[model samples]
Target: MKVGLIGFGKAGKAVANVILQSNEYSLEWVLRQSTILEHRHVPEFLGIDSKEPGLIFSTSSIEIEELLSKHPVDIIIDFSSSNGIYSYGKAAASRKIIIISAISHYDEDEKQFLSELSSKTIVFWSPNISLGVNYLMFAAKLLKKIAPWVDIEIIEEHFKGKPGVSGTAIKLAKELDLEETEISSIRAGGIVSKHEIIFGFPYQTVRLIHEAISREAFGNGVLFVADNLADKKEGFYTFEDLLSPYFTN
Candidate 1:
């Protein structure tokens, strides 16, 4: 499978490294919003050994359709901002390319746009794509179902300077019947990722925790989504939708 990446930030670089190391996927091109590091080969820049072109470019360097036409890819893994999809989504869907977005958050309009695109091609979006985090969410939901009266709260910790509350925590809050205000967030140091769901019972408490020690966790998630959705039919799929089948009891 040929792949195109849509962001070049720290996390994006880590994801690119994962693709370079994967024998099943070829990194074809990367598009970033900034002009820095424009026109660099992804493998040479990351010091990986692959013959794939994997070139990098600024979004402004070329039109979105032209870029897709010149370097076609089977999938476009997006670690870019929410609006980044606005640039290439329709164009890629028109070409029947699958999209997996790990963008942290998207408003209602963006959700609608993605839903519409799914009619043409597979569209997979996850607020938090770390497989472990998604697993944590599923486990928490199960515990809640088993004991609906138990009180649940979510806690998330990330590196400092995060601009908003953790979207995963917010989703957890919704699942466990808590408000966004009830989800706690700690932004300090260089914490890769941490989420804990505390279920308080009358006699005791159960704590379910997932901590990501590296950004490569998300890269593995990219691979998981790729493997599962490779031959899936055109539709809008959530991380939970794809991950749920593997959670068979």
Candidate 2:
């Protein structure tokens, strides 16, 4: 698949490396703010070797559109900020390009815009793109079916710099039909990410945990979803939707 990427931050860098290393996808274009391009280690930060070819970088939507006109891509994976999404999503949707966004923390207006955009093109949006976290969500749903009366709580831990509750925790709580307050967030050290779902009964408790050893796990998950989405029909989708096949088996 020919792929375009937006953002060159940590997660974006990871995703870029995965695409570069993969034989199935080609990294055709990257979009980032002009400020990010000022970094001295642009190629190194994007995991692109000096000898690599066919990768275009741009800071404007018009440039991205021009590139798409010259070289159409099968999918566009976005790891940009919420503002970036707001800026670029419409352009991609107008061309009926598939978008896979890993951005979180959207305001009401942004959410509404994305919702409307999905009708015009396939949009897979999720805050937590890790396969393990998505599987955890699946497991939480099963646990709810097996023990509906059990009280459930989500505990998530991330690096101190991470803001708000983990998106995986919020998804888990949503899977179990619980409120955000039922999820606890812990910020410490440089932990990549960790989440635990606890099921409490009168005399016994059960816990399901997933911990990321590295960011590559998330990169792999993102690629997996992109591959699965190749045949999906247009609409807004999520990581949970990707778990449908597993649920049947």
Candidate 3:
């Protein structure tokens, strides 16, 4: 499988590591800004070089677009910010390329971008791409059905270097119809990411939690999606869509 990555941040680098290690996929190109090198030594830290097979770097969407036009890719994974995502997403979707995005916020153009490609291509867009979170989402749905009246709250923690609160927790909150502001966010030491959905009522309380001990946990999910995406028929999808049908009793 040929794959391209957008953004070279913590999560992006983590996913790139997994893609490089996986025998089933190849890293075609990484779309990032030229000044990204001046901002931080990403390539040195990550040991990425353009000389490597299928490895290329681009500073603009036009550069990436030209690269893709010359060499079609099976999948393009966007782990970028809202602004960055829109630039690449438009081009990827235009070519009907399967896109797996882990961006947090969305815009009207971004929404319409996905809408246009929803039927002809497969696009997986979610705040948290972790498998554990998706499983947690599945569990939450069951809990909501079984214990409809349980008061639920979410708390999340992330690295201080991170920009904001846990997008995953916020996403889960949205999924369960909980107020986004009710989902708490914490920034501390070297913690990668952690989230807990707590349910409490009169006498007892239940908690569903998934903690990421390492960034690699996220990489696992991205790799899994990349592997499965190659064979997807075509359509907009979610992590739940990839998991085999399972029920809670």
Candidate 4:
């Protein structure tokens, strides 16, 4: 698959590295906010060995239509800001391009826009796109369904400087029908990301945890989504939709 990426921030760069190393993807280009690294190749920028074009372009330098025309890709994976979708989503939909977004948070209106956009082209969005985290949520939800009375508390930990509660933790709480107050967060050190769910029983406590050792987990999740969405029709999809089949009663 030929993949185009948006945003060259920390997460985007990590995802690009994974794409460059994967046998399943050919990174065609990257678009970001600045011109500092304009036209630089991903491999050269990251000091990795790969043969993909991996060209960098500034949004200010070219329009989305021109980029799509110049670099036709099989899919576009976005690890950019929550508002990044606004820029390229409609244009990509016009061309029936597939978009996989790993944006962490979106308001109701932004979400509705994506849901509507899916009518034109396939749109996959996941705040916590890690396979492990989604699986943890899936399993946690099942456990709650089978044992609804089990007391549940979610704990999320991140590195210093992360504002607000963890989005994944909030999603998990919502999935389990727990209040936002049921979530706890801790920020310290250089922790990449960590989420733990503790199910309390009268005599025992079962803990399910998913920790991202590195941002590459998101990259792997994208790879997984790309492989699965390859044969699906146009629609709005989530990580859970892609992962539910793997969990059976």
Candidate 4 yields a Cα-based lDDT of 0.92
RMSD of each: 1.0, 2.6, 3.4, 1.1
TM-score of 3: 0.86
TM-score of each: 0.97, 0.89, 0.86, 0.97
Give the per-residue lDDT digits (tens) of candidate 1, residues 114-178. 99999999999998888988888888889999999988878899999987998888888887788
lDDT of 4 by residue, 1-249 (tens): 889999998889989999999987999999999998998999999999998999999999999999999899889998888899999999999889999999888989889999989999999999888899999988898899889999999999999998888888889989999999989999999898999999999999999999999999989999999999989999999988888777653
The candidate 3 region of ten consecutive residues with least summed lDDT is 35-44
Q: Return whichever of 2 and 4 wins on lDDT.
A: 4
What do the candidate models score in CA lDDT, each in turn? 0.90, 0.79, 0.76, 0.92
| lDDT score, candidate 1, position 79 | 92
Q: Please identify which of the two predictions, 1 or 2, would achieve the higher TM-score against the true structure.
A: 1
In model 1, the Cα lDDT at residue 159 comes to 95
Candidate 2 residue-wise lDDT, 101-204, digit = tens: 88866677877888898999989888878888888878888889988999888899998989877767776787799999988899999898899999998899
Model 3, residue 145: distance off in Å is 1.0
* Model 3 lDDT per residue over 96-185, tens place: 788888886677787777767777678887778888878888888789888888899999888787786566777788778899889888
